[model samples]
Target: MTRAGRPTRTVLAVDGGNSKTDVALVREDGVVLAAARGGAFLPQTAGVGAAVDVIAETVRQALAPAAGAPPYADHISAYLAGADLPIEEERLRDELIARGYGGSVVVGNDTFALLRAGARDPWGVAVVCGAGINAVGVSPGGEVARFPALGRLSGDWGGGYHLGEEALWHAARAADGRGPATALADAVLACFGTATVEEAVIGLHLGGLQIARLHALVPPLLAAASAGDPVARSLVERQAEEVALLGVVAMRRVGLLGEPCEVVLGGGVLTARDPLLMSLIERRFAECAPHARLVVADVPPIVGAVLLGLDRLGAPPEAYERVRAHFSGAAGRAAGDASGEEVLTAPAG
Candidate 1:
């Protein structure tokens, strides 16, 4: 309800990534009202029906604070990691409608939200490389294109997981005398402290070692290449090239590269302070997409989801900034300890 006693329209924004799900609520004027976070609900990782349950539950919790108020139905915009498939999008849309969100729902892949966050302009490209890699671009006329990212067997590649795995693979080959000796073998072996590469592999499956543990290997791999390890050097170079290629495809598909457009970079790997990898990516972009500038996303993807929710309500850019500033200040108050509601309230512009 408004201070003048009139009803207000509310919307929910959600970002479901490979590792986490974050949801937020906002007013038409753009103040964030509430927010929450949970686990990922990608059907590819969680099973179709199970993923639906996770998403439904996450939504229920996110909406609980304001549910049952006037305007029983609310607007909702969700960006999910594995909803690129139409069937998946349809399933989620149907579910949202059934849950009474009605004529207020938008479902899309996670990459699109990152793109929207980096550039509100209609035509732009977004490339994300963390545990995985993918790219997407949209044209001013709403045309969209994406690259196939089917992982190793399909040569669908780029990102930290693949890079770390490649380092280990070559290290094992070198240890077995089938390949030239490189510093990666010694570096990775020290990472695991196992006498052999085979033992390190076995220890990974024994389960107490968190998968995040492997994230530690990425920097050393880059360091090895910086120090002139040929295999590691080639691996980083190839991965950087592939990521750049993905960005180029997005820009060209949307007819934005030769013109004015922003190519946004997001995700953990890109956020990492690796000078070599960063420089290589910038160099490739200079060659393949001279007109597209790489902009770092200003807010996390969930905030992008919130902006998306407001966008559906026709909120102006100033409206977004007002609320964004509020949230930014609020988040700063408590820093890392901010709760979901606290984070939402931070954007009280």
Candidate 2:
């Protein structure tokens, strides 16, 4: 698709979440020139203007490494975590358009990026469980299923951030003898390198500890769960159950229950490959829908963003391969490759 001149930035793809955002610059023919990761894109917590700044800066970083990327792109597609409601998506879209990063702009829920990245069949289900939890389902008959995903108010559950908070709560209670004693208290101390939960609390209140670091505690929490910590184990189980519940509900709503369809999962929690969580999900899902095949999304969600851009271009298969090859040496590449037509992740819908 290129003539004699350098390649221009035809598509700008972004995957924005509560914790982080990724941006990539792609040519019209689907060759990725640059991909970069940046700060959080949670408009709810960070204000729309600040969140948009982060996104724009990340877009700049993406184009930074590209030798021939145009200053303006033909299209910019951003899937953001806090953009759950239609109003939110439109507002964010308008803000992005005002920045003039691209001639055309589209903003959607971050789950949609995961959906397009993981699903290749044009219809299926996707459940994302990283810092937060959300699900989306698309049916062949053109039905769509999703949730407000506005956290507790919207009946959402099972995410790394929640898991960390629960762990902290139990640990604090155990320290004060108000709850059943579990290994989590000492585990928390070891994880944070702190003397006591009291010290941690005081530090946080005194503006010493960054509350944002709370989500990072998820790994230690999972470790404690795996090491026979009852409360931790219970929390992990609940998360697995929630993941299963979301998938089952989404599929049922879209009329994909018991059908031979793909169930795609992504985010840090599911990607951890935890034995208890994985087994519980498999067992619970099999009971609900035995025929639904499950897949753990291996590639970065930004790849899903790229796929969304390519879809609009209706690029040839070879163009897809070119884009996949551009990410071949990335730190987050899948075990094999996405150079083939097959989608390595995302839901079909």
Candidate 3:
């Protein structure tokens, strides 16, 4: 309890991604008082202040029904997208602290959340292939390894957005006789409702269609690959290679390649569980790191944030189980709800 005779909120756990931000107010005992989801946390594009404001607004909505006041939690565990470097994490941490949102704050790249969410132990590797691609590893002794993750400029490849662009590129070339004809041309035309790949290209170039809409092409591209389209299959194969390579290299850097370790795979692309892609990824890992175990994260990344917060608070083991059970039940209910919103909360008792 606080000096005000109210229960202390132990952690304001946040998992902010490129598309959405999830916030949960968790007690030291693992009871979740309030939770909410909000818009993108794109610090790179929206500026640090604006990106944090999104989290602030979402927190306000979450805390509205709960019995709390300023300094809602003892600590803030914010694992966020766009915080790809130590400097970026520091900037965001400083901003959250300046706002007086919590008594203390810790910020890290979202890949860390993915790692904690999926891996059975605290130390392992995580590879995220979402709108962008990145990898991170943590050693038992607290050493860290990560990538610049600046997309192609940083020697990175394979993500849903990049795959979509590749689909478009191949389709356009095939239509123009510059590349071998493949079903990707038909897939692209069907995806954009265009008569030809050129029309879709023109639409993208002239702003008739949002460039982000290209993400929609990923599903069709995967479907084509599953159906054995040579060009599509090649792209999927390359993506699998990149995913496996990121995990293998991170494990090697952290001295886990020769040891038994879990390689947690998260992000939308990996979670989709496309059979062909999964098979290829498994094969690569089997050949490269036989001792490594690959696991696709079954829970949302916010669970990792909550767990990290609990870890910082030195909460008991039961606290961890309580939080995991809460989210697991919430996920089950969410599957049945038609609203499609990812909100989870438990009434104060």
Per-model TM-score versus the true fold: 0.84, 0.89, 0.92
Instruction: State residue 311's C-alpha deviation in candidate 3, in Å.
Output: 0.6
lDDT per residue (tens digit) for residues 1-349 in model 3: 5524665558999999988999999998889989999999999999999999999888988987663556778999999999998999999999999888899899999999888877767889999999999999999999899999999989999899999999999999999999988888998888888998999999999999789877788889999999989999999999999998999999999889999888888899988888888888888888888877788777889989999998898877888878877887788744443221222121222
Reference-based TM-score, model 1: 0.84
Where's the lowest-lDDT run of ten residues in candidate 1? 340-349
| Sort by lDDT, top down from the best | 3, 2, 1
Q: Better model by lDDT, 1 or 3?
A: 3
Q: Where in model 3 is the C-alpha error above 4 Å?
A: 1-9, 65-69, 333-349
- lDDT string, candidate 2, 1-349, tens digits: 4535744447888888877889987876777777789988879877888998897788767666553433457888788889999999998988888777778888889887777666656578999998889999989997999999888999988687777778878988999989989777876676666899877766666878766566767877777778888888899889988998999999999999967888888888887877767777787777777777787766667777787787776666776667655664464565366632232222232
Tell me, by lDDT, which candidate is best.
Answer: 3
Off by over 4 Å in 1: 1-6, 56-73, 101-103, 153-155, 205-213, 330-349
Ranking of candidates on TM-score, top first = 3, 2, 1
lDDT of 1 at 233: 90
Clashing pairs in 3: none
lDDT of 1 at 150: 63
* Best model per TM-score: 3
How many angstroms is residue 349 displaced in model 2 relative to the true structure, after the best TM-score fit?
Answer: 28
Query: What's the distance in Å from true for residue 53, model 1?
Result: 3.4
